[model samples]
Target: MQIILNGAATEVADALTMAELIEQLKLGGRRLAVEVNAELVPRSRFSEHRLAPQDQVEIIHAVGGG
Candidate 1:
């Protein structure tokens, strides 16, 4: 399956959930935000939100600086 990740074409497994994607990208347990097809997916729903092919995904990580 293919999805547009952060404005770039990317390949991913079919039936992939948001949580799985996060882990695949090595982003699990990090402070982050995810949006799919212009809709925001809450962290609580990451496990349940399944991504579809051609879906637009945006992942933003929170960086700490002081």
Candidate 2:
């Protein structure tokens, strides 16, 4: 499956849910928002929602600045 992550195009295995991607990418507790194909993927739904091919994923990690 091909997906454009952030801005780069990459290929990943299919049947992957948002939560699985997070773990696969080793993204833990980043305190960010996840958007898949123009739709916001709620944290609670990440585990259940399956990502499709060519889906656009934008994960914005929260940054602390003063």
Which candidate has the highest lDDT of all? 1
1-66 per-residue lDDT for model 1 (tens digits): 999999999999999999999999999999998999999999999999999999999999999999
Candidate 2 stretches greater than 4 Å from native: none
Best TM-score among the predictions, by candidate number: 1
Give the Cα lDDT of each candidate.
Answer: 0.96, 0.88
Q: What are the root-mean-square deviations of the candidates from the true structure over C-alphas?
A: 0.7, 1.1
TM-score (C-alpha) between model 1 and the true structure: 0.94
Positional deviation of 26 in candidate 1, in angstroms?
A: 0.3
**For residues 1-66, what per-residue lDDT tens digits would candidate 2 score against the true structure?**
988899889788898888888988899777879999889988999999888888999999988999
Window of ten residues with lowest summed lDDT in model 1: 32-41
Q: After the best TM-score superposition of candidate 2, give how far the Cα of residue 30 lies from its true spot, in angstroms.
A: 2.1
Cα-based lDDT at residue 47, candidate 2: 90
